[model samples]
Target: MKTIHLGVFEVAGPQVGGTLSWPHPRSRSAQFHDLDHWVHIAQVLDRAGFDFLFFADGYGYPSVAGDLPETAARGGINFPSLDPAVLIPALARETERLGFVVTSSTGLDHPVQTARRFASLDHFTRGRVGWNIVTGASQNTVAELFGHTTMQAHDARYDQADEYLDLALRLWQTSWDDDAVRADAAAGVYADRSGLHRVEFAGEHFRSSGYFTVDPSPQRVPVLFQAGTSGRGREYAARNAECVFVQGTTVAHTAANVADIRAQAAQQGRDPASVRIMVGLTVTVRPTHDEAARLRAEFEEMQTDETVATLYAGNTGIDLLALDPERSLEQLLDRDDRGPVGQMGQSNIDRFLPKDGSAAPTVRQILDDLKGKGTRGFQVWGDPVEVADELEHLMDAVDLDGFLIEPIFDPADLEDVAELLVPELRRRGRMPQEPVAASTLRERLIGADGYFRRPEPAAASAHREP
Candidate 1:
């Protein structure tokens, strides 16, 4: 019965999940590098009352067991991406109250660089920025790109990620005090030297002994987001993230995940209710039910089984191409001693692999129900009213905070939602009547009662180990 929160999942590539919408006549995904395409989408969402736009980035492309496919380029799958961070200032210039969440990995990027970039983004976006902290994905492929002689163990990466976040926190939360700036032209004093403290963190994977380069921006730290369903990932998100994302296969499963994360947050010395939970959602809306169904049919035609295979193999590092169709997902996970999946990892494996006494889903299931019935999360296809109805029901069903809209087409699917779905949601009192303006992205997006208040973390010096 609370007002529903919302965000759109984005990437700087033509592909998202297994959907081939970029090839569609109406899709603008092919022009991904163009600011015009992004600006248009950002403006549309800003007008509609969307809270934030999240870019899911990664350093690696799909390569199963170190096998590079020549077809990757031809397929135009999840490849050939521009770094999404570069577009934030432009989008911020175009819209107000639309926060930006950029994904950066601890394994692939140094903590200092991550801290500096996000601080700059916070300043550029006027406090409308978030960081989706991920360990890394596509281990073998990314390792090759970074010239890692051997891949770090999955849990070990999480261990290192723990320290990485602390280091970044020192820069964001402790390096510069809120009143560090003293802009008094008469005295020629711009900053107080006493307020700037040097960060002296020496973790296993990183070390920093200098003062944080940037001054504190609004919110001090960008809103923290985490999107991993693995056990270690759940603990990591619970302990650190203000916003958590889940890709649910069923209504019951996602609800359980929500409860689990909240419970873990409580155990981790944080408020259970303050960990905002968002599920991935794929919406297909039209003026009529028949039109919606027809549109959905077309989407299914575009989202081929091979595409799902690519998505699965890339995220889980399990090569569906080389495996027997009948093999269980657990069997594949068992074979990989290094734990192929970590943060931003293995949604399908967690969904399809049977933990109950039931038979495990075969690798072939990724085509059937895994990637079937549309893209990830709770899916709906109908008129505006019908779509809105299902969304409300699901929100209550799971005690959800928001949904990450995964557009099947770049701007077209989002256009349909903005044009058709938002008005109905507003009419039903599930959305604000006016655009949310002059609010910090933290307060407007993830920081509130229904959406969970963004907690102010203590200064990083307090976290130093004795």
Candidate 2:
């Protein structure tokens, strides 16, 4: 079996994103812009041997209730959303091995700029960079800002994304031969004009004339990541994603997702094993079970049910606040299947305890679960050994490549895991004592060691310019 890779998802706040169970009215009490915390966390992850730090992004805050804009802004609910790419350069300066992966929506950004930015970061990070691709999900937000009237249909968005990827690949891979740049100060020449080629692309969604603004970085194209299990989404991942992030509530559900993507990869003539599937998990680990429980309870008390409902409303595009308290998810699903909240209901109803034994969990339960001090992803609370056992169980049950671990409250969460849990995992033969090697992100993850090498300088042509 291949060594399992690990990653952590960053949800910038005092606590994880999602709902809280605390009863007191919530406020913007948490400090959001402590760059020190981010830098410290990046160093910890590098020291802990994590594969990457993945940041999930959205273009706009949740807009559901008539008072959403004000409510979200005032409450600091994902309000200080900063560009993740900007943070990577700082993080890259602090750590050597940990990779940086960030989400950028194709729908919201121009392909030329997006392509150049990632390439620049890859160079800055020395190949430890990845891109998580997403299409814009909120139309109201886009319409308000960019003059768009609406979001594209679900399937149509994927269609446009396909063209966008094709254009990006042509610019990154085919635009210039590998040896285009030659920095020879003696001759006062930089590029070999013969080896450079321009890529002219025209499609329904985008048209770009490109000579890649940035030279090929350590890895010409950073590792690609996609998070979607829909039919169109799976097809997109197979052709593009090196690793796919899956969000589902159960091992069984995630296994099905992994199978679907692998099957899709095989159909595309790509090795099914080439695509690595990682499930989301939030762990609260300690020295003893009792201590873990107490910590969890504290988190629970700080969260509120209303917060959960508000968040659910924004995610599903259904105002859970408007529905009757006793309404079943069966009722909601019957009305619409256009968004993620509905899909979460169908995909994860069994993992949660139903409020009245007829539908989804109550807003209170959602808050309670989310607010638990060491909660997020798939919650498993225990001692180091216990946590290791659970990790093994998840890896086996879900057939996962590894986990996208979310720190309960801070980066210290990862530090504890590394100190307490990593040793136990190594003793059990689940993880390696020494890292494989420091190489390109693809080499590190895919075992494609010899596949990548620095390109030789392109030959300078001495042509008659007279």
Strongest candidate by lDDT: 1
Which residue pairs of candidate 1 clash? none
**Candidate 2 structure quality by residue, lDDT tens digits, 8-100:** 887554345554422223222244466777887788777767788998776665667534655455444445466667888888988878889
lDDT of 1 by residue, 1-466 (tens): 6878889998899866655677777677889888998999999899888999999998888775667565456667777789999999999999977889999998977899998999899899998999999888777788878898877776788888888888887778777767889998999999988888877776667878887889888777888999887788888999899989888677887888888899999987788877788888989899999999987888777666666677667777766666778877666555545445533355556677757678877767656775544336777899999999999988899888889999876788898999999999999999888877746777886555222232433333333222
Scored by TM-score, the top model is 1
Model 1 weakest 10-residue run by lDDT: 449-458
Query: What's the C-alpha lDDT at position 48 in model 1?
Result: 86
Candidate 2 clashes: the total is 8
lDDT of each model, Cα atoms only?
0.79, 0.68
Window of ten residues with lowest summed lDDT in model 2 = 457-466
Each prediction's total of clashing residue pairs, residues at least 3 apart in sequence or on different chains, is 0, 8
Cα error, candidate 1, residue 9 (Å): 0.4
